[model samples]
Target chain A: MTFEVENVSKTFVSGDSDEEVIALKDINLTIETGEFVSFVGPSGCGKTTTLRIIEGFEKPTEGTVKDDGELVTGPSNQRGFIFQNYSLFPWLNVIDNVIFGLNINGKPEKESKKRAMEYLKTVGLEDFAERYPSELSGGMKQRVAIIRSLINDSKSLLMDETFSALDIQTKHKLQNQILKICKEQKKTIIFVTHDIDEAVYLSDRIVVFSRRPGMVKKIFEIKMDHPRDRQCQEFEDLVSEVIEMIGEVEED
Target chain B: MKKFRNEYTKETLILPIILIIIWYIVCDVFQLIPSFMFPGPTDVANSFVRLAVSGKLFKDVFDTLYKVLFGMLLASVVGITFGIILGWSKRLETLCKLVISILRPIPPIAWIPFSIIWFGIGIGPAVFIIFMGCVFPILISTIDGVHRTDPVLIEAAESFGASNSQMLTEVIVPSSLPYIVSGLKVAIGIALMCTISGEMIGSSSGIGYMILTSTSLFDTGSTVVGMLVIGIIGIIFDYIFTKIQERIFW
Candidate 1:
């Protein structure tokens, strides 16, 4: 199954100024099944805007998003979204938070709870099944958020700078965990990040975006093996290549 | 003495005991306000015992308590329902805002005449007054809670295919719980005040009626007893509400 974006453009009109700001321009990209694609660019580059457009959280002004030839209009269960803010409900315990998607979809309690338990166990958080969001640390909360999104039957995941708020150690650890899980599940992941090194380490192909009214600068295919090492010469070269694309856009 | 002072047992009693002693000296010993106007602590305690034995204290207290609880329960149902609906629908909410603004400012006591004319005396009017008093605070709070719900949470839930009803039940309501609880806390105070005011204005039985009747009869001791009961009940409700909020929110 291939997901496609064709000739997408987004224009935001400022209410006070009545100034029309073009956030994205004529964007075209295709995400094949089971591929890890990362969008890396500077702030206001509309990487997140592009991701949200794909998730159907925001509508494109001038293009169509098709999932296997079906028009995407609004949010659906088929595309899982992992937010940066760790969107676990403060009122729900860890287990219930993870299983919330299933609950909303009318799954039986026993089935949902069992599936929730398996996901929690996969993340080594079975012991915290009853803990509330307030009781968990930042990293732990994000971990729960990730599991919450993944426990659903979504074939594709859209993650928006999910680890930017985390400490470096935790960020690295989560990156590795996400990579391993995505590989095993063979899920299509479209990750958006401002961190070039992170994009380099995790993605199958990196799509560099220009600054404002973001357009695709370049797409580099990282033909490296699993457990990619940042210390490798090839990894360094790819990171530099992605950075140069970003830097070149800033110069103009 | 030091150990006793360190413990709350002694610290908490010190001020109340001192105030009571001063009260006894000024009113009983000096007869400053007259025993009929301001009864001593012993007289008040005696009145409390008399009312308890005669069954009036328990009866009146229970009547007031029942009205408050029943009214609050009604207010909660109506408040939360309207809150969610108005909170969800922008157009309806804007339309109702004018009416709510006009009605909410009029105290429940101010509604006594209308309530008496409509429901007429006793528990009905008292319950109506209390329900009116509590509903606005609860409604507004629920609306605020829903409106202020974290945008990220809404986006996350929507991304997973939550329908509008699912969004209400699972996301909006639960996320707005803290605000709702706070509104309930404020509403409880208003409910009690309205219940007492309604009872005082129209009812024949209730702590408020007891206090009003005792004042007219120059039974200051019984009036003091009634006041103390109301204060204690309010404290207990606040404590219980806090405990429940902590358990659910924390």
Candidate 2:
């Protein structure tokens, strides 16, 4: 089972006069089941736009995205989104925030609470289940935001700069934990970020994007094994290589 | 025991205490005005005791409370409903601007003539005037609050499958609560002002009517007492509203 896209493009109108802004351009990609893919690009290079299209938050002006076997429509339970800003509802306490998807999607509050606690435990935040989102640190809030999405057990996870708000140390810690969880659960994830080293580190493959009205610049398959040794020559070489590719693209 | 002091709570008390001291020193200690012209706090209290003994003060206070509470209740229900609809629906909001512009400038007291014409000189007209006074402040602030909610929240909830009704019930209303509380606080003051004003012009048994009759008879001491009664009652009701607001909001 794989998710595939063919010739997808999206354009938005800027104003009343209808000045067109192309956010994404002719894109083609595929991800094998349970694969973790990272899209690395400069700001406004359409990495987030591409993920939004795949998640059905926006419709492509051209082409189609097929998941397993069907076309993408408006957001479905099959897709889960984790925002960079950790969009946990600030007014809601942690348990209520975690169970938000369940409540909004019509799950009974009692059952949703049970599943929410289990998911929060998976993120090691069961103790914070009753605290408000504002009471959490940035890293902890991000974890809660992630678990909120994960609680639904969606078929695919769409992460838009998921760990960018975190410091390097917290980033690595959360990334490792997330990798382990996704691997154990066999969950496919498509993440967007600008960090080249991070892209090479966590992703099964990295999709490099060109600047504005972004098109797929290149796709690199990382041969590194799970629980990757960051010091390994192969991992370092891929990181340097991807960094250089991004540098050249940004300069152009 | 060692927690930091709340500077804000202390600041709120400074103005009231300063005003009280100034009022006392000017009227009582300094003797700037004659006792009959500017009675001291003791004189006001004596008048209160005299009126209470006669049992007329209670009836006047009760009549004022009944009118203000009933009118304010009507305003709260209608104001919140319209405010939510205006805030939530773009087309409705656009349409409302013209109507709001027309209705907002006319003061509730200014509508006294029309209210009297429509409902006559009684509690009905008096209550209608209070409702008119309170509704705009509540509605405008509530709409402002609803419009200020983060758009990202709406998008996130929509992504998670919140329907329009669920979004309004769960997201929009709760988010606008602080503004609504502040609005209601302002509305309470306006409600008190309108109820007294309506009674002065139209009603037969309120503190405002008592103030009118005392002034007509030139009982300056009783007139001072009537004014004091209205001011003290206004403060009490405002204090109660603030307590309710704090309980509901945070």
Candidate 3:
């Protein structure tokens, strides 16, 4: 099912001031099923806001987001969101954290555990299943957070700078893992990132956003397959293109 | 574990020993205060032995323990439940905020008169006072705990399709556990204090009653013994609670 964001504009009012701040202005996009798309922009560009709208966490002041012609009302398991903060439950162990969505969805305990373990095993964290989030490293915790959403069989994954907090090496490693998993599952992804390189490397298409009062400046389709070489001329070219687009937005 | 236990034992014993030596020097050697007014450490020890043999110490300990435990149980049940509800519902919190603000600052001792009038002189009033003392701390802590929960966690849970009740039980409650636990710690201290105060003001039994009667009769050693028991019990309760906190939260 295709997801459509139509003429969406969001306005935010500060608690103290009467002045209005338009965070997003008349943004529009269509995300085809099983396609990988990335949103790249500077801070305050409303890339995160756009992702939030898609997940139905925040309603746009104008326009609508439809998933296969169904109006998105509120947060649903159908559109999974991976936060910048790992947001793994500190109290729950790795396995339990991974199975959280299934638990909330009322799946039987045995089946949920089996599904959680399978995801954990794929991430090679099955051995750490009983360990709490505090014991896991940052990358491991984020993996659990991803699996937490994935086990629900969400139609799309909306990542909000999920790797921005991690070190470069760990971030790249996780990017590879996420690419592999998304490809294997053929799940649609709308990844938000400030890193143009990441956007070019992972996304089938990149939506470059302008600064404040965020509007789509350009959309670049990457004509490459999975496991795109980061150092390759074309990959670097696309990354430079995305950077130039954002740089132009900044200049404007 | 064994190393930790040994260190803990050694650390705990050192202060009490030093304090006892100082007490011996002041009251026994120097005879700073008259024997009837302030007892020596040895005298307090002798009083403890005497009370233990006579079964009065155990009985008073039991009486005080029963009141604090019973009151704390009731307080926990009511406090945590109401705290979660109020913390989640802004309307409920707004309705109760003024009442809580008005009631919270008025110490459990302030409710003693009403408790006595309402429930009479013995365990009833003591329990009521202790419940009042314990409940507010637990309730406030629970509210703060739930309120202070990381917004990111709530957002994550919502995106995972957690129902409101599921959010409360799984995310809100468990995440707030540290706050609730610390609250329970405060409640334990307050509960113990209320139990003793309640007993001292009106009851014929309990450690507080014994201390009151002994002090009035100039039985300073017995009074010191009661005071020491309460202090030691408070320390033990704190120690146990800390252990539980370490196991659960850390």
Whole-model lDDT per candidate: 0.89, 0.84, 0.89
Q: Cα RMSD (Å) between model 1 and the true structure?
A: 3.6
Better of 1 and 3 by TM-score: 1
What lDDT does candidate 2 reach at residue B26? 88
- Segments in model 3 whose C-alpha atoms lie over 4 Å from true places: A167-170, B1-15, B29-32
What are the per-residue Cα lDDT tens digits for candidate 3 across A1-252? 578999999999977887899999999899998888999887899999999998988999999999878999999888889998759888888888888888888889899999888888876799999998888788778877877877888878899988887888878878898888788888899999988888888999999899888999999999798788999999888888789889899888
- What digit string (tens of lDDT, one per residue) describes model 2 on residues A171-191? 888888779878988899999
Clashing residue pairs in candidate 2 are none
TM-score of each: 0.95, 0.88, 0.94
Docking class of 3: medium
Best by DockQ: 3
Best by TM-score: 1
Candidate 1 lDDT over A7-67, as tens digits, reads: 9999999899999999999999999888999998878889999999999999999999987
Off by more than 4 A, model 2: A15-18, A66-73, B1-38, B229-250
Residue-level lDDT tens digits of model 1 in B178-224: 77888999999998888878988888889999999999999999999
Mark the 10 consecutive residues where model 1 chain B has the least summed lDDT: B1-10
Q: Of the candidates numbered 2 and 3, which has the greater TM-score value?
A: 3
RMSD of each: 3.6, 3.6, 2.6
- lDDT per residue for candidate 3 within B119-140, as digits (tens), equals 9878999999999999999999
